[model samples]
Target: MSTTIEVEQATGPDLTHRLRDAIQNAEFAPHQRLIEADLSERFGASRASVRTALLNLAGEGLVERLPNRGARVRAITVGEAIEIVEVRLGLESLVARKAAENLTTKDAAVLRELRGRIESAANEGSLVEYSRVNQELDERIREIGAHATATQLLERLRAQSARHQFRLAFVPGRAATSAPEHVAIIDAILARDADAAEEATRRHLAGIIAMLRAMD
Candidate 1:
């Protein structure tokens, strides 16, 4: 009975989460239309549940509802992408500065370990693993910064950023190139150099913005 209940729930909101991840992971490319009937059959959900799930996804910014065409994956424009990077530049630099100011010796050691893991992930060419470690690193820095409001805001921004990363991960040389850039930011934070940490963070994000523009 418990198992049965869990399955029922999984076929509902859990299906929404699964779709959200698929969009974020680029399994569903931008502008790809989502057919309600298709999703219903694919996820073994009812048409009503799938429709509800589509609306939920739209609210999350993973999908957009068209006027008469129904829902499709949200396609990020170049200008919008730049705007996201611009905002991230400010937020990330602030986080880096705070992390530098508040970092403990133990926190520095852990960051160093995480950097090694990032390097390993990059070398192994595992974009998914690299993305996971990168998120862990970002969260750790936010925790070290100890700013509740800023961290909460950054988390919201990160959801949008994840999709950009998923798309960019396919760009040749992106992962390998970003690894050292990330290390520089970590090094500045670990060294307790607030200015350097902020500068490094700004440069890292700026590089991404430049690449995005070039791609466009």
Candidate 2:
């Protein structure tokens, strides 16, 4: 049996999340019109609420407004995907290094718990769970760093390039490979080895590029 989400009960975050999935998961094909009336009916929201969510997605670059076509899911290009990954490598390496210097015992424990969940999700091959858990793991690393500027930038990048990130995650070997890379990052942080943490993070993202190239 398949599970279904009841979008009628959704608030802002819930609406935004569903729209994000719709765009990133390709539920609404690229260049497909997201007419307010249609989406309001489909997602069971008022036009105002749906407009708020679509505007939010527009700010993220996930949706674009046409001169007369209203809005549509934007097509992500390969060049944009590579550029986003390049930026991620630099910022995430800094996150790992700063986390190594700043993580508390409590934070390390939480990281371990997240890693456990991530590994289990990956082993089960649940793409939805793996994506959510991996996002939390990265967010936790950013939290440990306490680098407000970096986190803010990452948040912006996340909105702009979520489609690319989703595509990258679906590549073969990515989930299985990322689980151990998370372990290595956590191990480096736990040991307070900033250099190793930074290197591990860079190499991990580098592996993503390798995987992307392999897919080509």
Candidate 3:
């Protein structure tokens, strides 16, 4: 039985976004076929819209198109995931620096609150909660940075590497180790120190690369 999403309207772009979210969230397992008819019924979108959405996600490296077969979720290997993170290390560092440079009083307050929640989740050893809040903090930083191009690239890279990240989150002591790194990022941003923010971002992503290599 296919699941149905409770969306009022599913335009092509909306369907693509929903599909991307589903893939990233593991609702659709890696390499699971995305049947157009199933997706159309589930999202309340037309078959044509589903095709367009699939094509769009394929372009984002989230979906694969197989000749003589339908589309399926793209399975990113550990090596590819490391490469993606290496790319992210540079882009995210830039974003972090920009975020620090553009930090406002309101942004500082928001980041501090998120930092507290991240620490709490880490202390409680809630992997799911920690991952959720960590993503939120990243998104907030991207917004504050106001770099649309980097943000778009990072979004695609993140989605492609989500599965590997999800696995890493379950590694023993991973969350606790990453918690301080996240705090450092928030601290640098709060201090409006662009250099520190960039360095902290690089450190965080470099840690991810190291973890991925260990898994490999």
Candidate 4:
């Protein structure tokens, strides 16, 4: 007998977002096939809705739709990973600079809290929690930057970079090193130093890029 995947009824966007998160967190490994019927049942959405979601994810490069094989999580190549980080270096530096200039007291508080959550998850070796908090921190920075266009662009870049980011985080000791980098970023933002914030963001992302390159 085939086992049934438990799925709760969810709206289109919600289901898409959930699947994206699952893919980013390594719940669905790289190149894992995403069958429409299975996902429709798993997300409790109609098959049509599932197809739409898959197409959306495909546009983001999080999933690849094969002509005959259907959709599968995208596997990032070394060259593609390097390109993603290079793009992030420029975009994230801009975000950090703007975040430093625009961060409110409330934003600072929330950022510090997120930094703590990231560090705690890292120390506890919870990759899922670490990835989740890390993405939240990125989004919060974009939010504080308040540039709608940049935020939208960064969101797309992030979706494409998810697989590479997962590989980096899953490496032993990578999370430990990244926790301090995030703290440096938060500290610069709190100090309201735009240059420092931008520089820190560049350094942090550059380090990750170097590590990835070394692995390749």
Best by lDDT: 3
Q: Rate the local accuracy (lDDT) of all candidates.
A: 0.84, 0.81, 0.92, 0.85
Mark the regions of model 2 whose C-alpha exceeds 4 Å error after superposition: 1-18, 25-27, 41-49
**Model 2 lDDT tens row, 13-39:** 678778886776667777888899998
Q: Which stretches of candidate 1 lie over 4 Å from their true place?
A: 1-20, 33-60, 67-70
lDDT of 4 by residue, 1-216 (tens): 122233323466777888888886678878899998999788778786788788888988889988888999988787787888899889999989999999899998999899889889988999879978988889899999988887877777776777777778888888888888998999999999999999999999999889878978
Best candidate, TM-score: 3
lDDT accuracy of residue 110 in candidate 2: 95
* lDDT at 208, model 3: 94
Prediction RMSDs, each to the true structure? 4.2, 6.3, 4.3, 5.2
What 10-residue stretch in candidate 4 is worst by lDDT?
A: 1-10
Candidate ranking (TM-score, best to worst): 3, 4, 2, 1
lDDT of 2: 0.81
Clashing residue pairs in candidate 3 are: none
lDDT of 1 at 111: 99
Model 1 lDDT per residue over 63-152, tens place: 899999999988877777778778988998999999999999899889999999999999999888988898789889999999887786
lDDT of 3 by residue, 126-145 (tens): 88999999989999999999
What is residue 137's positional error in candidate 2, in angstroms? 0.8
Error of 3 at 179 (Å): 0.4
